[model samples]
Each structure stands twice: as C-alpha cells, then as structure tokens.
Target: MHAVLKLSKYLKPYKHFAVLAPILMILEVAMDLVQPTIMQKIIDDGIVMNNTLYIVGMFIVMIACAIIGWLGGAGCNFFSSKAAVNFAADIRADLYETITYFSNSNKDKFTLGKLITNLTNDVEMLQRALNMLLKVFVRGPFMFIGAVLVVFFTARDLFPILFFVVPVLIICLYVFIKLSITLFRKVQEAIDGVNTRVQENLSGIRVIKAFNRMRHQVKQFTGVNEELTKRNMTADQVIAALMPITQFVVNIGIVLALMLGVVKVEAGANEIGVIVAFINYLMMIMNGLMSSSNVLIQIARAIPSAERVVVVLEEQPDITNAENPVKKEILGDVNFEHVSFSYNKQVEPVLKDISFEAKAGSTVGIIGMTGSGKSTLIKLLARLMDVDEGTIYIDGFPIQQYDIETLRNAMAFAPQKATLFSTTIEENLKYGKSDATKEEIKEALVASNAIEFVEKLDKKEQHELTQGATNLSGGQKQRLAMSRALIRKPKILVLDDTTSAVDSITEKMIQKNMKELKGSTKFIVSSKISSIQHANLILVLEDGRIVAKGTHEELLKTSEHYREIVATQVEKGGILHE
Candidate 1:
C-alpha cells in the first residue's frame, strides 16, 4: 500500500480527471439505483390501477435516467483512460532517465534483466491497477453501499439476510486476498526468471549456434517457460475458486430474501412491488461485492509490481555532480595519484595503488594480460566508478571537482567491444557529437580509415546498421566506433583494443592518424605489442600495478616482461617492432 501511494505524485497532473471520474461514477450508480424504484412505481401505481398515462410517464422518465447513466459511464471511462495512460508514461520516462544516469556500480547492482522487467512488465501492472481504480473500484463500493441504504429505507426486514450473508462472504474474500498475495508474488518472480533467460539467450545467440548448443538452449528455455506456466496456472486456480464460493454464499442470501418477501406479502406487511424492488437491490449488492472482489485480486497482483517500481524510483545514484561544480575545459593531461579500486569491498582490489601521469598531447599505451585491470583503470579515469583511495585529476584539478558532463565531454572512449544502435552510419557517428557537421563526420571517417569501405557503399554514411552491428563485419564495426569517438574532437581519447579486429595495415594506419591529431592526448590499451610500442610512454601492467613504464627502446632493454611479450609476438610472426 505504501508503494502504491508513492506513485500518487504521478496523478498530480491528472488530478482533475482522477477526481471527475469518481464523480461521474457516482452519478451513474445513482441512475442505476433509481431504475428499480421506478419499476416498482410502474408495477404498483400504474399497472395495478390500470392507469396507462402514469405508466408511460414513468417509463419515459426511466429512459431518460438510463440515457444519463450511459453518458456518465462514458465520461468516467474517458477520464479514467486519460489519467491511467499519462501516469504510465510519466513513470516510464522517469525510469528511463534514472537508468541513463545510474553510476556503474548502481547499474551493476540492479542488473539488466531486472531493470527491463521493472520498466516493462511492472509498469504495465501498475497501469492496469490505475484503470481499475477509477472504473470498478469506485463504482463497486458506491453500488454496494447505495443498495444497502435503499433496501434499508424501502424494506428494513431484508437487513437480516444481508447480516447473515455479508459476514461469511467477507471472511472468504479475506482468505482469498491473503493467499493471492503470496501466489501473485511468485508469479511475478517467474516472469522475471523468464525475462532473464530470454535476455541472456538473445544476447548470446551467436555463441550458442557456434557451439551447436541449440538443443541445450531449448531445454533451458523450456524449463523456465514451464515454471512460469505452472505458477500462473496455480494462481489462476486460486482466483477461479473465488467466484464459485462467493456465488454460493450470495445465492443462499437470495433464497432467504425471497422466502422472507413471500411471507411479508402474504401477511400484508409489504406490497408486491416493494418486495420485488428489495430483491433487485439484493442482486445489485451482490454484483457490487463481486466486482470489488475482482479489483482486490488485481490489487494483490499489482502490489509486487508496485514495490519493484518503487525500488527503482527511490534509488539514488552513487555518483553525481559536486555541490559547487566547475565547468572548465580539460587540457588533455591526466594524473592518477595512489589510486586503488575494488568491485566489492570484501574482495581483493582490482587495481592497487596505481599512479601515473600523461602529458597533454602525448600517447600513453596500456598493455596487460587478461584481468590485469586495464579496463578498470580506464573506467576510473572516466569517473564511471570512483576510486577506493586517492584521486584522479584532469589537468590540475581533481576529476571529482569538475561537473560530470564537462568531465565526460572532455574524454572520448571506445571500449573493446564496439556497440552500435540500429540506425544509419551517420547517426551512429553523431552519437559522440550530435551537432557534428557533414564535413567533420567525413573527416572522422577518413581519420579512422573507415572512409574506404564506406565510400564503396552507395549510401556511404547513410547506410543502416542492424542491431549490435551484426550486419557489418567486426573490423567495420571497430572503424565506425572509432570514428564516433574521434568525431567529438575530444581533448583526451581512450581506445581499449579498438583496432584489434582490423587488419595490421589498417591498425598502423589508424596509429599514424592518431599522431596527426594535434594536442589530443591518447590512451591506447591493447594486447598487441605493435599497437603500443610507438607510444611516447608505455605502461606494462601486471596484477594491477605498473610493472614497467618507459618508451619502447627503454622497456626492451630494462623490462623482462616487455621483452618476453615482444619475443612472443615476434616468434609467431604476428607483429614486429621497427
């Protein structure tokens, strides 16, 4: 309930519709309540007295009431729909924004599958609940209470049947509500499990196919699907039993009411029309209770969804702009002073007491074996994750003192795995700088050595790439990603194995182009010795420490690890240093 209440802020903009919907629903219910009384009048005052004029007058009035009821119901539905859709839209927008701004650790904590489920499936549940609130939730109680009030005024004796029936039905509903809450939570978990499996499978489809694991994948998916189906069926069975149980209790009340009515009529305690109207009121009350039960079932399901959404909404990002942010432009120089970091506090640090400096406009190369913290170091420099100890500075100021946007805008980074959206080549490049002109985009492509193949295509930069850039070659994707980073004209450029997929000739050409880009500091991380040997300063990393920091000529003579790496690559004839 608290979680659901938190979402009420979303209703502020649509409060007018939210308020109007219930008002219209009350009018509709009032119209419905009057119809039975009018029928009673026609039967007793008109038909019994053979007064045709009175009967026509009552029927016309009843028709007008029915028309008004129709209009009121329509108006209620219109307002309810508008409020519900806007509420959902606002939540989805906020959720997307929250995700986009999440720090690396925060994102890691939530995980991709859970976030997707919360945004899509959970938000949908809340939307349905919103619609139900203004529709049946309000109308149901109004009908139930109004019927009871009218029956009490017209036939006080019918109260006995309600007293006997309502308590038993309430007890049954309470039990169903309790049981449904637990079952619905399991249903939502099953949905998350299914979504996780599907997301994993889709992302690794190529690996599954390459290893001929299609049958294994199918078996794994079937397990989750069956679990989801079983849980849903169990929940549905529990909810399905509710209607029959409720009906049995209401039917007994109906029988009792009829017996009492018959006796009253015979004893001249109540008129036949009054008895008929009382029975009609009893049915209306039963309909209202049943509608309320359905809404409760929906609420039970929505509770878990609401909790999930609240969890996302309430999360505060660990990284944010400083209180007094500085927006000065970066000068390409970077310094790390006694920096250390760990993904988790309980675990050993990934990077340990890492300290280095790269002058503006210099090429700094980072080479390490797998798990040596090459990527982690880059992440710290970009402020994607903060250091466990010490500080990283851009130019002369600590990176934390700068506004986050300005700090990030100063550096352009390309990761080991190149990612491209499902869009045109020009649009992908512009992601680095949205306002980049045609000439700047062409220059970026030329610098990255991507213009060769791009010019061969009829569409050139307009060529559309598929999801994950699967439509393009691995080398082609790398070039496009590099072009995207270069187009920003950043003060500092970080490339993490960006050219590993391309041919050696193309890689050297890219290296040549990097040297030509004046005043831009470059940090290149690669496994290939050839890629980093030309740097003004090369840092050979092992177990998160700088094992050697020197130019290629100095490292070859003084560092055994650097010598071994060069010897290994040269023995394979894969690379050679000039």
Candidate 2:
C-alpha cells in the first residue's frame, strides 16, 4: 500500500483531474442525501397537511436534485477515466525505458515471458485500481458520513444503532483485505510461472517438434495451467464468504432500527415521515459500505502488481556508462589482457586468463573443443558482459570507456543462433546500418552469398519476414543474418559459427568476400578449420584457457586439442561447409 502511494507522484500533474472527479461524485452523493429530506417535507408538510401547492413545489425540487446528480456523476466518470489511462501511458513509457537499461544478467534472471506479463497484464491490473479509486474513493466514505449527518438532523433518536453497525462492517472488511492481499501475490507468481512455460514452448517449438516431445510439452504446460487455475480459485475463495457476512450485518442493523423507531414514534418523539427517512439513510450507509468493500478488494489486487512494476522500474543496471568515458577512433585493433569472467559467482570461469590481439585489416580465427569459451570472448568485446577479473580494449580505449551505443557502432557481433524480427526484409537489414542504399544492400547480400535466394523472393528486399523468420528455411535465415553483419561494415566483424548451416560453397563465398572487403577486421570462431584457415592469427582455446596462438598451420604443431578438432570436425568438411 505504501508502494502504491509512492508511485502516485507521477500522477501529481494529473491531480487536478483527480481532485475534480471526486468532488463531482460527492455532489451526486450530496443530491442523494438531500432527496429523501425533500420527500419527507412533501409527505408531512404538503400531502398530509392538505397543502397541494407545497407538494408540487417539493416534487419540483427533488427533480432538480436528480439532474444535478446525473451531471455530476457523468463528469466524475469522464475525468477519472481520463486520468487513469494517461497515467498508465506514462507508467508504461517509464517501464520500457527501465527495460532498456537492464543488464544481461537481469534479463536472464527474469525471462522474456515474465517480463511481457509484467509489462502488459500487471500494468493493466494497476490501471484498473487507479480508475476505481479516483472515481469512487471519495464518494463511498462521504456518502456514509453524510448519511449519518442527515439522520442526526432528521431523527437523532434512532441513529445510535449505526455506531454499533458501522464498526462491525469496518472490521469485517479490514480482515478480508489482509487475507486477500496475500493470495493475490501468490496468484501473480503463478501467472509468471505460466508465462515462462508458454514462452519456452513457443520459442523452442521447432526443437520440441524435432525431438518429438509434443506430449511431454503439453503435460508440462498443463501442470502450469492447472496451478494458475488453482491460484485464481484460492483468491476467489477468500471473497466467497464476504458478501453473506456483510448482508447478515446489514439485516441485523435494519431490524434493530425498525424496532427502536416504533417506540420513538409512539412516544411522539418522531413522526412516521421521519422514520421513513431514517430507513432510507440506513440503506444509503450500507450502499456506501459495499462500495468501500469493492475499493479495498481492488487495492489488495493492485498492491502485488504495482510492486512488481516498481521492481523493474527501480532496478539499476549492473553495467552502465561511466561519467566522462573516453572517446576513441573507430580502430579495428583489439586486445584482451588476462581477462577472466563467469556468469555465476560460485562457478568456474567461462573464460580464464584469455589474452590476444588482432591488428587492423587482419583476421583472427578462434578454434577449440566445445565449451572452450570462444563465443564468450567476443561477447565481452561487445560489452554484453563485464570481465570480472581483467580488461579488454579497442584501439587502446577500454571497452567500458565508451558509451554502449557508441561502442557497438564500431563493431558487429552476430551470435551463433539466428534471430530475426517480424518485419520487412529491408527493415531487418536496416537495423545493422540504418541508412543502407540499394547497391550497398546488394553488395552485402552478394558478399554473404545471400543475393541469389533473396532475388528469388516475391518482393525482394520488400518481402516481409514472418515471426522469427519462420516462413524462411534455416540456411536462408543464416544468409539473411550474415548479410546483416556484412552490411554494417563495422571496424570489427565477429561471426560466432554463423555459417554452420550454410553449404560449403556458400561458406567459401562468404570468406572470399571478407577478404575482398579489406580494412574491416574479421574474428571467426568455428570448430571447422577451413572457416578460419586464411587468418593472419589463430587462437586455440580449451576449457576457458588459450591453448595455442599462431597461424592455422602453427596451431597444428603446438596444440594437440586443435589437431584433434581439425582431424574430426574439419577433415570431413574440406569445402568449408558442415
């Protein structure tokens, strides 16, 4: 609850709307209170007193109050809803900015699925609470207190029954709130779990189908679905007893008020018109109490959700640009000085004591056994993660010394896995370099050996790439991704086994183009020796440590592990395709 109030600071500029909305709603409540008093006047002072003119006058007054109430209620609804939606837009914008700053560690900590849920569903829950509270928060309590005041002025003798009745109502609602908030938090966690499962299934649907694990996947998803259902039921269970309990309290109060009213009216302390008004005020108080109960229920649901959004918004990234970071020329020269890093604090390092350099206009091929930290090395060069132990530099400037956006422009690091957005083919390529021209796009596609197939597409560069490029074949996707890297023409190009799916002929063509496109440095990591055979330097890594560093031929003599990898994975693929 404290967390929610703190977040409301963003709503301060919109507070005028917030204030105006409730005041309008109070006018409606005020009309409700005044109407019954006018009816009492019509009955006692007009109809029963045989004054025809007074009856007409009182009836006209009641109609005017109804018009004011209608207009006030409409105005209240208009402003409150407007404030809620605009506030949600502001919150969503802030949340997206926060997401952009999240470290890779934090990104992996909360998977993409859970983040989507937080951004969409959790935000919606908080928005609903805001709308309800702004619209009804004031009127509910004001109506309750105002009813009591009207009752005191109209018939003070029977009103003491309310003191006992209202306290009991408040206690019941307070306990319900305490119990429901706990269950709502659990429900949100269950939703997160379900989101994770669905996201995994969708992203890896190809793998699941290839492995023939559809039933196994279905069983896993059902387990999460069942748990989510159970959690929703648990939240519903807490409120199941609430309405009956509230009704019982209201009924008891009504019977007591009637019994006491008869004694007072018989003693001439009150008239029947006054008793009638008393009954109406008592019901008005109960209506107000019920509305208050609903408001509390929304608050309970919103607390857990609002807190989740704030967690992401308030998070500070593990890596951020330092103040006054050094600006460096776009030099392709690269160096690593005894760098060591681990994704996990307690585990063995992913890359240990790794050091190497590839001067401008040179090629460095990285080869090793699986889990040899080849890909991890380039990831650090891109500032995807920090080197926990040592340092990395580009043209004598530490990787951390440049802002993230500025540094990335000088280098292109395409991962082993192929990822493409659901957009036009030209749009996806443009992400690599925003202002690429048609001739440049053709040159890059030709360099990556992708031009042949792309020219066959219905719309060529204008073709739409479906979700994850599912409509395209694997080799085609690789070609498109490679073309993106080529088009960037960065100071350094790092390809992490990106040609693994392409044919030997295509791989050879890509390597040939890299040589022709001189000046841009290339760092190729592959188990296949042919991919990096033309390198000026070769670094053989094994178990996070560098085993050998030299030309391709030099590594065959100095490194036994490099020799074995060449004998097994490379010997079968002389054409550079595997």
Candidate 3:
C-alpha cells in the first residue's frame, strides 16, 4: 500500500486519465451484470411462452450490450495501460536524477547490475502492476462482492450453501497464494542472477574473447537460465494447480443449486424460469470469484519487486547533507585535518589521520607507491565519502555543509577508469560544459594532445563514439579524458593517474599542459612518481599516512622515503612507474 501511495505522486498529473479508465471499467462491469437478468427475461417472457417477437427483441438487446461492453473494456484498457507506461517513465527519470545525486557513501548498497535491474526490470514490474491496478483491481473485487451479495439477497435459501463453499474456496486461495509467493520471491532473485551474468559478459566481452572463454561463459549463463526456468515453473505450477480445485468447488455449488431448485419447482413453490436464472447466477458468482483469484497471482509477483524497490528507496545514505543545508562559497582553498576513513570499518582504514592544506590555485601533487591512500585523499576533498574523524574544509567551510551537488560541482574528478560513454567526442567533451562553444572544445582537445587522431576520423566530433571508447586507443582515451576535465574550468580538478596510459614524451606534453594550468587553476594531481615531478607541493604517503611532504627538491633532501621513491623511479627509466 505504501509503494502504491508513493507511486501516486506520478499518477496525480494524469488523474483525469486514471479516473476516466475506472469509470469505463465500472460501466463495462455494469453491462455484464445486466446479462444474467436479460437471460432470465428471455427464458420467462419469450422462450417458454413461444413469443417470437419478444425473443428477437431480447436477442438484439443482448448483442448491443455486448458491443458496448467490448468497447468500454477496450477503451478503458488502452488508456489505463498508456497512463501506467507514462507514469513508469516519469518515475524512471526521477529515479535517475535521485541516483545521480546520491553520495558515494551509499553506492556500495547498489551494485551496477542491481541498479540496472531496478531501472529496467523492477520499474517494468511496477508498470505491469499499475496496469493491473486500473483493470483487474477494479473489476475483480467489484465482481466478487457484487455477485456474492446478489446471490445472498435474491436467493436467500441458496445463500446458506455459500457458508460451506466460500470458506473452502478462501482456504484454497490462501494456501496456493502462500506457496506461489515463495516461488515468486525466488524467481525474482533468479532474474537478478541472470541480469548479473549478462552485465558481466557485456562489460568483459574483450576479456572473454581474449581468454577463449566462450564455452565457459555459455555454460555459466546456461546454469542461471536453467535456475530461472525452474523457479518460474514452480510458481506457475503452484498457481495452475489451484484453478482445477476452484473449478471443482464451483461445480459442487452448481449441482447443489440445481438440486434444491428442482425440489422447489416440483413442490410448485418456484417457476422453471426462476430455477434456470438461479443456476446462471451460480455460474456468474463463481466466474467473478475466479477473476478475483487471478489478482492473487499479480499480488504474488508484485510483492518481491515492491520489496526490492523499497530496499533502495528506504536506504539511508551513509551520509546526507543536513536540512536547510549549509552553503559554501569557495575558490578552491582545501584543507584536510586529522581525517580518517574506511570503505567499511570492519576492514582497516584506507586513509588515516591524513592532514594537509593547500591555498587557492596552487598545484598539489600526491605521489605514492600503489595503494598508499593518495587517491583516498582526493575523494575526501570531493566529499564522496565523509571522514569518521576531524574535518575537510574547502575555502574555510566544511564540505559537509554543502549539498552533494554543490560539493561535486565545486570540483572535477577524472579517476583511473577513464570512463567515456558511447557518444560523439563532442558530447563527451561537453560533459564538462554542456554549453561549450566548438572553439573551446577544440582548444581543450588540442591542449590535451588528443586533437590529432580526433581530426583523422572523417566525422571528427560528429563521429560515432563506440562503447567503452573502443574506437580509440588507450592513449587517445586518456588524453580525451584529460580534455574533458580541463574543459570544465572548475575550481578544483583532481586527476587520479590521468596520464598512466600515455607514453613518457606524451605524458610530459600533458604534464606541461597541466603546469601551464599552475597558478591560475587549483589542481590536485595524483599519480606515480613521474607524473607529479613538477608540482609546487608534493605529499609522499606510505600505507595511509603522510611520511613525506615538500617540493621535489626539498623532499629529496629531507625525507628518506621520498629519496627511495625517486631512486626507484630513476632506475626504472623515470616513466616506468606508471
């Protein structure tokens, strides 16, 4: 019910459509209701009396009613399904916006595949449930209760029989629903398993082909597919098995109604037409109950999907900006004071007691061996995750004071992954500045040394951007990423090993480009020893602590850790550290 109410916010905009569809559904049900009474009239006034004109008249009335019923049902279904689809689409867009604003502290709860499933599969499930909401949810209970009440009121003698059949019927429904739900819940998890498989295969197709794992991947997929089939079959079988039982119960009621009606007719207490009409009502009531029973199946499927969506929507972000959130207005003065952090405290802290301060528009290079917490420092500045101890300030204000969007916009981040979407080169560059002029985009590309190959392509920025930037080489992708960050002109730019893929000469060229950014732009460059050689300030970290901090010259003279790092890089031909 809470999920349904939560979704109503989207439905409010289409309330007219929602209302119209249900009115039509009620009209359709009304038409169906009149059919039994019409049949009684035909039997009593026309057929048994051999009145030809009365017979023809009632037959015509039935045909016209049937047509109106069909149109009403179809029109209602059309509008309702359309509204449900549109509502789901609106919610999907909102979910995406919400996801984008999520702090990184909460990212671990949503896996990439699970997130995709929520957007596509789970939203689709909600869509189907909404469609059923308009039609079945309307038609089912109305038919059930209406038929039951009509039977009880019009044929009071037969009403007593319902006490026996109805309870059995309800019990049957309860048992099957419980069993089906168990299967349904498992089936949804199986869908996630299969989704994960497909996601992994697509993301690592290159790896699979390179390793000659075609048969192995196929075998793995087969296993999950088979499990899905088993779960689906189990749910359907449990559901299907109950239908015959329900039918048998209906048959029992029909026989009992006929027996009592005949005994009354023989005793001259009831007319033949009344007995015939009485039998028809029995069938109608059973049919209506059956329709309502199908709703049980829908509720079963919706339960698991609703639970999954609720998990995400109910998730408490590990960190969230405070209400009437504090605002920070800064031009890139960053401070990290005695900060500590861990992805999970069950594990060791990824960064511990890390402290540093950089004034506005100064170049701060972070140098370290692998996993030395250099990248973790920049993430803290980005406010991706909050520190458990002390504070991180930007321009004299704690970052937590700012809303997540404001904090992220204050900085640009290009992590080691060098991610680019399957879009035009221009679109990728415009990610930095959506309204950037063509000249500015071209200049950023040139400055990052990526303009050469970009121009070589016949379509240039208009050319197709292949998946994973597969159309370009590694070095080209890296430079293109650099261009993306540089184009943003943000207050702070943190590059986590942005030059790792390019050659020494090309790396030097990009570094020179970054140096040109020195006093005018505040930059935090994280790299192996080679990339940060020219920074005004450098921090050399060991494990999660700052073991050394100074300029390259000062560090070399004063810190043994810095000396060993420089010596190792020099022996490895300077650029080999990447």
User: Which parts of model 1 have CA positions greater than 4 angstroms off?
Assistant: none
Cα lDDT tens digits, model 3, 1-578, are: 67656667888888777888888888787777777767877887898899989989999999888899898899899989888899889878877766666677565567666767778888888788778878777877666676677666666666776776778888888888778778888988888888989999999998999999999999999999999999998888888898899889988987887888788778877667766666676666666666666766777787777777766766666667768665655587888899888887799998889888888888788988788887777877777778888898887878888777777776777766789989999999999889999999998898788887899989888877888989788888888887888887778888878878877888777777777774333445555677776777898888988888888789889999888877786787775323
Q: Lowest summed lDDT over 10 consecutive residues: which window, candidate 1?
A: 569-578
lDDT of 2 at 428: 82
* Candidate 1 displacement at residue 455 in angstroms: 1.5
Tens-digit per-residue lDDT, 1-578, candidate 1: 88989988999999999999989989999999999999999998999889999999999999999999999999999999999999999999999999999998888888788899889988998888888889888888899999999988888977878898878888888899899989999988988888888999999999999999999999999999999999999999998998899889888988888899889889988787887887788888888887888888888998999998889889999888899988988898899999999999999999999888999999999998999999999988778988999899888899889999998898898887999999999999999999999999999999999998999988999999998989889999999999999999899999999988999999989988887998789999999988888899999999988899999999989999999888888899977545
| Top candidate, metric lDDT | 1
Any runs in candidate 2 off by more than 4 Å, and if so which? 50-53, 570-573, 576-578
Order the candidates by lDDT, highest first: 1, 2, 3
* Reference-based lDDT, residue 363, model 3: 79
Stretches of candidate 3 above 4 Å error?
149-163, 214-216, 261-276, 322-329, 518-527, 575-578
Give the candidate order by descending TM-score: 1, 2, 3
RMSD of candidates 1 onward, in order:
1.4, 2.0, 2.8
lDDT per residue as tens, model 2, 314-430: 778888897987666577888899999998989999999999988988999998878989988888987888999888888888889888877888888666787889998888888
lDDT of each: 0.90, 0.86, 0.79
lDDT of 3 at 344: 79
Reference-based TM-score of each model: 0.98, 0.96, 0.91
